[model samples]
Target: MSAATPTAPWTRTRLRTSPGTATALFLLVLLTACLAAAFPRAVDRYEDRGLRRTLAAEAPARLTVDVTVEDPGLELTPEQRTVRVSDPVTHAAYRKIAASLKAPLTADPHESSYGTRSAEPMPALDRWLPRIDGPPTQLTLNAQGGLADHARITSGRLPHGDYTARTMEAAVTRDTARHLRLAPGKVVHFPDLDGRPISVRITGVVDPVRPSGAYWSTAPLLRTPEQRSTESQPPTHYWTAALLLNPKAAAAILYTTGRAQSYWQLAPTTDTLTARQLPDVTRSLASIANGPGLLSVRTATASDTADVGSHLGDVLDRYTELRSGITPVVSVAAYGTGAVACVVLLMAGGLAADRRRAELALLRSRGASLRGIGGRLLAETAVVALPAGALGLLLALAAVPYGRVLPPVLAATAVVLLACATLPLRAMAAHRRPHPHGAA
Candidate 1:
């Protein structure tokens, strides 16, 4: 038999004799494959972190779905006179509408606020000191849900939900209490459009834990009273604030005011949101804003006139735009790393081919075909390259547990293919050249 006929044994013997070169080649392949697999995974992890950071930094108002419905207190009657809808029916309808609107959201509602407030401000007067005059103040009766969770009671206690009481139980913010010189146990009378006055007893003074948080964004005036001046002969400087009441008292406020503005809000929980879900969230918001999602909500609620609005869609759109701008940069970096790895692999393959030149020439003298020589080289290289590449990929996965699978898999495959192809191609190229020494 010819010396080169047992190619597998020769390849094994060559690797055993050149252990140092084989080890170096194996380490090189491992390092390059590791880098190739790690780059894209690292990018994916960074994107997810960035998305979470963006969501956390956003204002509550910018990330909440808000719906407003105005009850004009005028229902057309068959008797040609205006009739009012019962307070209980109106309150129940508002609750139903809010639930329907929030059903399609993927993120849990961090704060689901639904309430009613007087559309027009009413003149506020001190019940005890009726004759004594103070700065002109107006108040809008507001009954919002989940108030106790977001606020700390500084004095007295939270308002009781006593719909039967002649005087409505209410609370005021620290700012409003300070500005208006009001406190607990104080009774304030707000004159209604009808001759009778709506009496409210101050039960507690509250300080908002996060005045600028999403919860307070639902009712901004409650945190900071608005100061307005009219263009009258003697310019009137008046302050307007909302009086906090138990959610159960919403019906009474609607009854007293006759007409009021109601709001329903769904604030998304940012902590649970991930980069992978961003596209789906954006599409969902878009559907709610102008697509079939909005129509479905409207149909479910049976209220076409309800004003549905949100800044969440705009916020997500901006995030998508920012992500798109960053992707190309990351891709370029990954490609540059791969290019460098390929160059280094080629150099390593060339060195190995040079060391085996004498053996290759001897094989040629034994009448070994180029294909047979190339196949032996390929088999030897794959033994080292495939396992190294696989180990590198495993290391990358361990490092970034949250990364995508396909990108890293593709990266590792590319590295292994290049490493396995390099040595055979180099050996074939070197032997194809005409030699000055005619030993073969």
Candidate 2:
């Protein structure tokens, strides 16, 4: 007989490769890995966008309340009263008063009521430390009980007349630095309520300070009373406040005919409330309080991206244990399912051997040994391993970005791929067929 025609070396076709089926499955795995990497960010964007939509649908609102002396013949001066009111409870009360007036209030404490706006506050400086992971709210003091002793007012200028200004070389809280808009060396003017100029020079950037309560996240070592008393001059009682500029600064602007309707119109028309507006608003609020007032504006319709991040923190804290517990269970179930599919496929391959019996007989008639047939089939299945492994590894590499956040899922997928390779091969044996006449 002529020498058996030699088969081409190492082609997938020689390996009983189901190119169409394998390609489709390979693409599916690849797509899944890609989705694993990118889907979380997409989900976050969608959530924030939806929140904006929801807020827009809600009613637009604004309100202003005066904190003037309720007591008759009050002895305290306006500045003295404002200073004494600078504590946390009084701050919350301002929000309470705004809420009572039916305003949708979100408080910000970094927006200055008085004094110059500096991006590099002591709190922002503290954030540069390596172990400081969260926001400024949790900023801790050094062993000496100083949060950031290195903090200093780098430059002071009277850019806007009579507002003694000092610029820190660091980032200030967002309420204060929001005016900076990431533009350094630019002039940001804060004016008093009477349009009197209050100058502040921007030096650097800072973190945005949000409202207190469930989402509160920043803490700086407050100046002690001794430090306050020992100072050559007393410090201004600084407070951050957000006022509604759209609904008109004062209720007097509300027309009796339709105050609520006018408020709605006012809300949308507030196209811009600059950093200058905060001083006046703070003064406005302070006029009510009789102290140095600091104020900024926040839109009821706007969704804060930082707020969404806080929500994610809540999700982790609330569901971390539950998710951790469920993850292993789900992974095991999924891996077992993949293993079962591989096992079933391999068993089915044995059934395929029966259908090919006649073909095997023809080969044997030509003097082919059972060993050769088994060797050829084994070689074909083993050939699948390289492509499969390569595909799995490529998928794993694609999973890197997502694995930064969701590592466990990506790891489980790799394990499944490895299991698929070995278990399926174990299903089939390469033993020779018995002789037709039962002769060994």
Candidate 3:
């Protein structure tokens, strides 16, 4: 057998042996590393913005509808001389109608009139928190939307019991729980309409969703004494502290005692309500409003996205974003750095072009076609860039946490670096002219 012609040293081996090629390879690795590190950080800002936008679009969370019972002239005021008696509309009737609707309707306290808007002073809520040690805060008993939707539970959970039969458990505010020296699995006593003791279990502790960080709960006593006779409402109307009652406790205190009169539109969770779902819910409410007790059932035809986000807008404020600081700055910086790095790498490629020209001319003299020559060139660079790009990737993962844009960023960077690395070979191949000795 003829001795095997010694294969020309691979293009990669020849390139690695040169000082200029080795230096260019080292510099390319570093540029790739810098890009890998910067790109992900830049991408994170946009990811944060996207998260904010998603939160803002989730507008229906704070939405509420009010179905108030107002016989404006019928109810007795505390300052009125003629003893007021006999409420024409009662909460029992509204609750019954709401129960039948089977929509997301529940009692809302803020929207319902608790004497704040009324010309007359109403009877104060009594015995709700006989144990609270400060001036009474704003409080009311709600069958549905009161506690669960308005506050986040910090510990334990919400009440679970027979809502229709007895006093259900409740979740108290963190401060209130701390004040009462209560925690999950503890019991607290509240006085009923007749001064009888009503005991409830403390199921959890919650933090209210207050605007501007204001105190979310009411005082434990009536703001002012309601000097009305037995003909009017029970003292349950004037509570200062939020005594978040479960359905059972509401039944024991409001419905069964004949004191409930208002119905509110409650959302189960902030995310539970959406604008798309609101149409059918409002339709159900409109039908239910025609029921006996509700004087005016007011619901939203459609809630605006900005209006909803204004209440609990995201930190990035992407939906209602008047201004943002993170995403734009990082984007500009990332592009600027990439452009500068490309220019520097191009210069490096130009400096190394002469050696590549002679190598390609020799390969062509041996009858290497353009396609085969290009493949050889790419393989040579890959021997350097592939390992360098991997090192750059490892550096990025170590510096920036993996998530969201990382995989895509790595992919994009690999493409760009590999593309840039081929510039010298392409430049050299295109410049190699046919010579007298048939080398091209």
For candidate 1, the per-residue lDDT at 335 reads 78
Q: What does the lDDT read for residue 248 in candidate 1?
A: 63
Model 1 RMSD in Å is: 5.0
Structural similarity to truth (TM-score) of each candidate? 0.80, 0.31, 0.50
Per residue, candidate 3 scores C-alpha lDDT tens digits across 241-305 of 33455543333344223344333333222223332344444555455444322322222211111
- Alpha carbon lDDT of each predicted model: 0.73, 0.31, 0.45
Candidate 2: worst-modelled 10 consecutive residues by lDDT: 256-265
Instruction: Give the per-residue lDDT of model 1 (tens digit) for 1-440.
Output: 66755455866876898788778878988888788888877887787788778877887777787766676333434221111223344445545544443323543444556667777777776533322234557788887767778799999999987754247889999988887677999888866556576788889999988787677865678677887776876766777778898876666665464456766676766665667777677676777667776776555434576667888878777788999998898778767877788899998898888877887877776677789889989988988888999999998888778678998899899989999998899888878743434453
What ranking emerges by lDDT with the best candidate at the front?
1, 3, 2
lDDT of 1 at 306: 62
Native-to-model Cα distance after best TM-score fit, residue 267 in candidate 3, in Å: 9.8
Number of the predicted model whose lDDT against the real structure is largest: 1
Q: What would the TM-score be for candidate 3 when compared with the true structure?
A: 0.50
Clash totals, every prediction: 0, 17, 21
